[model samples]
Target: MSRIGKKPVDVPSGVTATVNGQDVNVKGPKGELAFRVHDEVVVEFKDGKVSVQPRTESKGARSKWGMSRTMVSNLVEGVTKGFEKKLEISGVGYRAAVQGKELVLALGYSHDVKYPIPEGIEIKCAKPTEILISGIDKQRVGQVAAEIREFRGPEPYKGKGVKYANEFIFRKEGKKK
Candidate 1:
């Protein structure tokens, strides 16, 4: 009964998808990714499209059906187009840089913070205050971005810190004179 689960995910040209048991694997120009469908859901590749359906009419099965389908869709899209996250640092001395496999950050800390980049993920610093994170796995890309932002989340008073490119920070008025 899930509308999203009813629509099968399309397998675009030049991208290949395979369903083996509960495992769904997809490979495309960008990269390859795999996902294990929940046991309550059934996944199948048919006619150049991947389909997901609930294994039973149980409430739990239905609840996971749509989510499983979306997960599969994300895998296909990830391998084909990949995913990216952009972070911007704002402050007098806040900056970021990538050297070798590590990201060096200066968030007004007493010492520079060094974060080791994970495999299969790429980090780039076009500008000292801009950080670009890209990878085939959507979850990992987001996790990295979040971790970086966690180092110095924007403060309401000064609105200075690392934050997402499109994020809006709520400003707080200073003490009245």
Candidate 2:
């Protein structure tokens, strides 16, 4: 049995959740979000909570059980508390700025990299080296952060580039003289 799948997702006060067939929708003070669960799992709402269960005792159903439950929980959390990701730019002359609707990044390149911000997502530059990304959808927030980090991943030698705020870069030793 899946431990995560067995636990029901509690719908906190001021947040509303609904299950329509394979779709789960959640609305809260912050915003609203929805998710479509796999056919191998069944979703239900009751007692101010949402639950997910496998439709059959099969490998596919078992694999999707916990995933479906987490998706429902994420929908509720996203609509209520939302999600956030922080990126740190580290390199000589490297920095970031929010220019209107685009994120302008200078990662030691000749030209500034401009990234157009997407709808429902917010990007802010607290400092020249700090990028804060927030959104109601967890997946979208993470995706945008990943895309920015991919532009200049941290190098093992100098450990310079865009990296997650909490991430650690395993530095490598320089060649011996």
Candidate 3:
């Protein structure tokens, strides 16, 4: 039995949830989102809560049970509170700015790196060294943040580059003189 699958996802007030076959859709104050669960699991909504169950006792079904349940719950949470990822620039002269719908980054390169913002995702530069990515889709927000960080990953020597705000960089000892 899957522990997480046993718990139902409660639909909070002012939020709407619907289950159609293997598809689950949630609409909340933040926005709307949907997810398609695997056929190995069954989805149902009753008494203001959504539940997931394995179709059979097979191992494949059991393996998807918990994952399907969590995906449904994430849809509810994502549509309500949304998701956010923050990145910090640590290198000298490295900074970020939003130009219209694009993110202009200066990572010590000869030319500035321009990243076009995708739909449904919002990118904001609270400070020259801070980048905030927010969206209802958790995957999209994370992907965008990863793409931005990929431009200049943190180096182990000086630990200089772009990284998650809460991330810890492992520093390496400098070369011998």
Candidate 3: Cα lDDT at 133? 96
Worst 10 residues of 1 by lDDT: 73-82
Q: In model 3, which range of ten residues has the least summed lDDT?
A: 71-80
Tens digit per residue, CA lDDT, model 3, 14-133: 999989988888999988898999998999999999999999999999999999888888888888888999999998899999999899999999999999999999999989999999
Evaluate all candidate structures by whole-model CA lDDT and list the values in order. 0.95, 0.94, 0.93
Backbone clash pairs for candidate 1 read: none
Q: Candidate 3: misplaced stretches above 4 Å?
A: none
Model 2 TM-score on a 0 to 1 scale: 0.98
Error of 1 at 20 (Å): 1.0
Off by over 4 Å in 1: none
How many Å off is the CA of 16 in candidate 3?
A: 0.6
Candidate order by lDDT, highest to lowest?
1, 2, 3
Predictions: Cα RMSD each: 0.9, 0.7, 0.9
